[model samples]
Target: MSEIKKIHMGPAKCAVDLGDGSERGEYVNQDYILNKLGRPHRAVSLMYCYYPLDETWPARARNAFKDKEITFQWDYPYDDYFTYKGGIGGTTDDEPFTCMRDVRRHGQDVILTMTIDPNVTDEHLEQIGKELSTFGRMQLRINHEATGNWFSFTKRATYQQVADFYIHAREVIKKFAPNVQTILCIGGVEHPEKGGEIEMEKEFADAVRATDIWSVDKYMALHWGWPFDVADEGGNSFGRSKVADTYNLTKLSEKRYRELCGGVKKPMVMSEFNADGDVTGPYEQAEMVKEFCDMLKNDKDQGWFNGFTFYQFRDRGRLGLEIEDPNNADCGIEQPVMQTYKEIIHDEYFYPEMKSEGDAQFPVKLRWGGSEDAEGIEIPLHFEKNPTFCEITFEDEDADLNLMMEINGKWFYKAPHAKTIDFMSAFFEKPLESEADMTLKIFAPPASGENVNDGSEDWMLNTYSTITKMPNIRIRFAPILK
Candidate 1:
């Protein structure tokens, strides 16, 4: 059992925003898609309003869970259905880009979002990297909620042009979709931690320089435990980590996006959230789904939290898709929050129980992708919810090459190319923790000649960050060419 891998935070990567007040009918209703595959967090989300009709939304997100281990979260529209009726090499009509090429040929994992045009430029981000350069692996989130005030391009893009278009659309997906893992999503509620959130956390740490994960889209209407202080430490519902919302908007934008990731702990996702505990009482959405799953199974913060999606999922017995808006009343599944989220998504702590042994250092801080630019990828490792022995290094120094890291076997090395992204990782000295098995690996090479993207630092590529934001699905290899 002491081979070197064991980590656990149990069950944290959950999702379900199929549709709330469906003006679209929860993607062609099949009982609103089996009430999201009837449970145990199979991950499901979609939204692609490019108009011109035909938003099958990746075949209704592969009809919920037909992809077996599905994990889809897609949202589109920065207005450019391939040049909205003709432009970037005009063509007219629509295709929704072949439904994102049939949602990557029968979807399995995704988290791509968009909505904030500010009349996007840079040649419409090189045609959004030629339409997201062959979606092999994704998690874009393009300029979403930049700093709030609701899009009109958030007051005309200027959070430094919305973090310089999130580092120029992740360097144009490293020249035509280097496996798209770009992220910089903000707006997790009115944001707070000091007036104007310390200058919007210094304009999101001076207009992005690195990213792949740092999401937020908070929500809370009738949350919990903080009536001034009757023993108020967020009032024990399960144990500690209290959660009560109305304005805390996902804990002040996840504590000001971890102070703008200065300490670079990358790997945090609440991508979009929800809460209503029945607007004050009445089974309060099943006690706000058991106090938001017991404050996310007792969060410890800085554990590099990953995925907690739950925006909408059928605002009621649809049966005519109800919508008179009372904050979408208990927002979704209804009736004691759908039987208390089917018994807290079949608890095991939500996902725990993969343990192997002990050492306790654990801080892989969730997965992140590759290519600072030079075209060389093979990203998509795991462990953000479970599995952690923590000790990761990578401050970027060109981030070297030929670095393959299998969960327990395949280990290839060659980082001496000098550049520094820092490395010191741990999840139990060096092996599985809580969760990470399908053999996670990382391999990169391709950047040469003038030493490619020598920006010197800024590499939190945390191996394309995704410590299980769903039922487990990792991908992104197709760059190591020349």
Candidate 2:
């Protein structure tokens, strides 16, 4: 196999809608957001500012920087027909529009999204594109709905509008943020009102390729609600033979996503993904994060491309959580999910196999064996460090041995016979000195009463001797910390 490529792994910033920061009360405090965003392996914040022009917008922007937050701005275009509660929508008519300016003035990095609108004239788009280019690192947001009226677009509109929007947005962005990184398609169909949304996404992605930006999303979900709830429905199965809705959707989404963007040269991102604290069980949420990490690691192994982001940090008021004791309105830290992200960031044991010499010291032993008659045996061996030699002995006369060994949870060796072992004990040239766990598995074939199945009748295998830190084992050390 070829060498594995390492991709940028991090958490999404601003996992919630900032409504002027006032309605949030003390719940929307900086410390809370910081703790959540920084807890991930890679720190990021997801933001959907209602109106960048509002005075409060800059205050929010400033607060984000103070927390060292990575901003992902969800830009809603100019539309007079809609009234964004926090004075956000209709970008052209808004005044004091300094949100992006504040970010740049503060020397902060940001991801500006252009939520495509059909009514945007070529000149207007050109100007918007110029502003984005000047800002640099801006991402275009493509939605199935029309920004012109904030409603679902017709099939024809979905394709033509998105295709045209990308062509124009790309032309302008190429001139401005030429090195601009990602182009995200917001609101991937959970349940497309019209089935055409999926097809439209493909069209938009194809267009985005011409511009050189990677493709991604704002939010995507597989299962949307808690168990036994009315809103429970799964989205983005990712072509798994058996759909595990409880697992994080990012993995499944990315699998299907690669299929969708197969020929494209750019990577993708989950840009936004998470369950409402109230709806998802704590342990389930943590499991989802683990699944997300597993997906990334697996993708790295397979040589696929892209990145990922967890959705808004705190759940918006739209979703209600049943209070346990009611001490604080804040959902008491979404422990399971939060811890999962923390583990992903802080824990180095995500994959059992050790990649570097420092990690090899911890070896885990896996064991398995049994008689051919009816039952089997399995044992787990823990090692203080990597062993110089491993020996397996069988006591049962009719036992057929099938044994295997693994280092750091990865398969390393397998042997058919325990006795005729006349080989130099397999050892790591560089012996690990720290505690580790290795797994050994033994399988004894079942016996058929007749000779038609060979002489093997009753089979039984067991480990009689287990040792760590053998006398002849040599130690070589290279100081990792200077």
Best by TM-score: 2
Give candidate 2 misplaced runs (Cα > 4 Å): 1-32, 35-108, 133-138, 144-156, 186-202, 211-264, 277-279, 298-302, 317-334, 347-482
How does candidate 2 score on lDDT? 0.34
Global Cα RMSD, each model? 22.5, 21.1
What's the lDDT for candidate 1? 0.41
TM-score of each: 0.25, 0.44
lDDT (0 to 1) per candidate: 0.41, 0.34
Q: Which stretches of candidate 1 lie over 4 Å from their true place?
A: 1-126, 131-136, 146-216, 219-269, 272-306, 309-401, 404-482
So what's the TM-score on candidate 2? 0.44
For residues 1-482, could you state the per-residue lDDT of candidate 2 as single tens digits?
01111111112321211211111222233224433433112213223322243344324433433444322212112221122222223353331124433322221223443333444455544554443443333344433222222332222255656566656656764554343444545333333336424334555555544534333343223332222133333533211211133223333334444545565444445544444444344555455556656655554344343444454444432121122224655554455555556546444433111121111111222111211011112234455555544544444432233332222322222233333331122344335568754433222211110012123321112111122211121222333465
Candidate 1, 205-228: lDDT as tens digits: 654337767666554442222222
Window of ten residues with lowest summed lDDT in model 2: 367-376
Question: Model 1 residue 99 lDDT?
Answer: 35
